[model samples]
Target: MRAAIANYWWGSSTDNRHIHWMRWGRLTAAKCQGGMGFRNLRHFNVAMLGKQGWRLMSRPESLCARVLKGRYFHDSDFMECTRKKHASHTWRAILAGREVLGQGLIKRIIGDGSLTNIWRDRWLPQHFNGRPITPLADQYVTRVADLITASGQWNEDLVRQVFFLVDAEAILRTPIRGRGDDIWAWELEKHGMYSVRSAYRLLENQRLH
Candidate 1:
């Protein structure tokens, strides 16, 4: 379908063996990059599917998410779920673009911290190395709340025991807001909300690199 659209825009016809004055790849580049601002249909499709996956991850209470989960990923986090054999085409399409959604998604920690897992989540502040502190942190310290006190403050001693010195320091410096639930944020946007524009931009940057 995308190929057909590209061919039509480039003036290719069934009867003529004419030259394509400009190749499809060049013509599809963004305007700022010196081509027609035509959206790459393949990437756009994946990105749109990614937005649905994002909704499933962040809005599990929605009817669509619940139905998918009951059928496909009952025991795993949406991001960690895998496609099973004999799945519907719709399920497969959403799974295909899951990685694009994961890359730009950020989990913000707040309140009780029960939903944020300490060792598994990316909530730790980044260091100079560009990696979160202690990517190899102990698996024993599972939930982020495990490192916090009943009084709603960090448990400094437990954090030191579970994480490396540097990571422990970083964790101690992190604060949890007292009244709200943990939330997911789209790191690409200022308001921390997901947008198709941000998803496309992320996909474009990734393709370039």
Candidate 2:
């Protein structure tokens, strides 16, 4: 398909040899950057797969998710699931998409901090990697729940003690509502809906930079 598109765009000369002017990579750049906003097939494919992966993660109760979970990831969630030795092509594709999701997904903590790990999860918004930069200060306080009081309030003193000054400030700034469950949200989308365009743009930007 890519070859055909390139052929069409850079048609053959009189000698039947293609007269390419610009490279395909440059042509795939966004129009604002001076190139046509053509989709880079590989990134676009992964972005599309990322949308499918998002659907699976968001709609765990769906038949497709249920079936795939039962077969490939019954013991773990989609984002953390691994590729088995004999995994099908579809599963591999979804996992590839999940990688893209991992790049931009973050847990939206709603006061109930049981779902996130204090150090492992990307819940810290201010940090560059969305995680606390401080080394673990205490051995026992491993989960975000440990930093929350019984009344659904942050244990300010405990948090400050558990992290460095910067991380403590970032954690204290995170507003925690009394919502029932913490949820994963897409950082690239305002409404948290995963779309191919957003994922594609993210991939493109990452590649360029």
lDDT of 1 at 50: 86
Per-residue C-alpha lDDT of model 2 across residues 111-151, encoded as one tens digit per residue: 57888887777887747788988876546877788888888
* All candidates: TM-score: 0.81, 0.92
| Worst 10 contiguous positions by lDDT, candidate 1 | 124-133
Cα lDDT computed for each candidate against the true fold: 0.75, 0.84
Residue pairs in candidate 2 whose N, alpha carbon or C atoms collide under 3 angstroms = none
Per-prediction backbone clash count: 0, 0
Superposed model 2: Cα runs more than 4 Å off = 13-15
Over 106-204, each residue of candidate 1 has an lDDT whose tens digit, in order, gives 667777888886655567544432224665633676778777788998888887776778877777776686778888777678787778887887777
Local error of candidate 2 at residue 169 (angstroms): 1.3
